[model samples]
Target: MLTIKSVSKSFDNLSVLDTIDLHVKKEEFVSIIGPSGCGKSTLLEIVTGLIAPSNGEIYFNEENVTGTTNKLGYMPQKDVLFPWRTVLENVIIPQEIMGIRKKDAEKKARQLVEKFGLSGFEEYYPSALSGGMKQRANFLRTVLTDKRLLALDEPFGKLDALTKREMLKWLTTVRMETKQSFLLITHDIDEAIFLSDRIYVMSSRPGRIVKEVHVKEKHPRSNGFLLSKSFSELKNELLSSLGV
Candidate 1:
């Protein structure tokens, strides 16, 4: 579980996040969505400890984690996979960084690669994989590292609509298998609705939580879930919340 309490971030005179409060329970998948430049990514960076928050606290399982543990796996807007490294090699980078023995790391990486549908492509480089395949590799890398929490900052933002849908469905499968706490930032309302256990809507500029809605849809949702009336209503509400 992760908790952000009264967290705010400012760059000089510009205030971005304003005392934002949110939480993700164990095994929960949560998302934050707002108009562009709403400090969603900034909030994520603060939680990841890439940047210190201007104010307040971040806790993991009830302990203050500010400037602390490396229990977080952050996937940015881009996969940023090493073009030179093969898929197996890319995923093992985390294990390498953690100083785990090569044999142990490869054993875990092999299982994860196969689980993510990249078993045969393990020897292939980034160039050999499609966008969706690359994202899977990216997610697999994150999963390989931080087995606790996944902080994904718009990982699907760069994909085409059809590819994005496919990624979302695949992502749901991935999350179910991993059971990691995921805090995702997405601009796509449909994507948020399709993937989240709960969705938090943020106000623009000096971002603050405007609304939080629990997604009642079941996990591993069917394709028809996206076409349901409940999905449309929630999407409309999110759009209206964003003032789009």
Candidate 2:
């Protein structure tokens, strides 16, 4: 339900994104992957209205929401959970900001805490949680915002490989259950293919969409799919798209 048209960004003559055009359909999961300096995060910042583009428009469900905040739920690379706040407290921050009542917000947050596997950890602080737990708490906080589309910027970057794999599997289940639209920024080809319905490969420097690869594999995809011939082919295709 989100569309970006010819969006470009620049800072003091250093061009970043160049005439980018992309969209996420309702309940669709899409990913953007590219070289390190290709402005993937910048594109997301613009999408989330953290920063305005130098050019072009952003539309949410066909309404122009360019240069506006709160249109999309954003999860940056870091979990950014407050160190002092308990898990339940952190999850309710968005609701508090939105003027939701403390009693009602807490009630909702409690339900999601259980749903997201943070059940008994409600009173625990960020320091006490494992890396995966921290990420789940962070994601739960984002989900509590009740935004239809979520802009995720490498939320699994900090976890160990095995933990990351487990989180991905969990995310697939969550997607099946929630059917929320996701716009993910990830460097992992497998992560993108494992979770995304379509992947956008970007060019370096002034990032532009160079290739769009569609993953026909249906979810919930299993771990064994990672070793399959189709997965290998898809990985190779993405590698080729990145010119690796």
Q: Which candidate leads the pack in TM-score?
A: 2
Which 10 residues in a row give candidate 2 its minimum summed lDDT?
108-117
Among all candidates shown, the one with the greatest lDDT: 2
- lDDT value for model 1: 0.90
Look at candidate 1 and tell me the lDDT of residue 51: 88
Worst 10 residues of 1 by lDDT: 66-75
Task: Score each candidate by Cα lDDT.
Answer: 0.90, 0.93
Q: For model 2, state the Cα shift of residue 178 in Å.
A: 1.3
- In order of listing, the candidates' clash counts read 0, 0
**Tens digits of per-residue lDDT for model 2, 121-163:** 9999999999999999989888888999999999998889999
Candidates in order, TM-scores: namely 0.97, 0.99
Superposed Cα deviation of residue 119, candidate 1 (Å): 1.8
Give lDDT tens digits, candidate 1, residues 1-244: 8999999999999999999999999999999999889899999989988889999999998999986647689898877899989988898998999999988998988877777879799899999899989998998888888668999998988889999888888889988987888999988888999999999999999999999999999899878998999999998888888887
Give the clashing pairs for model 2: none
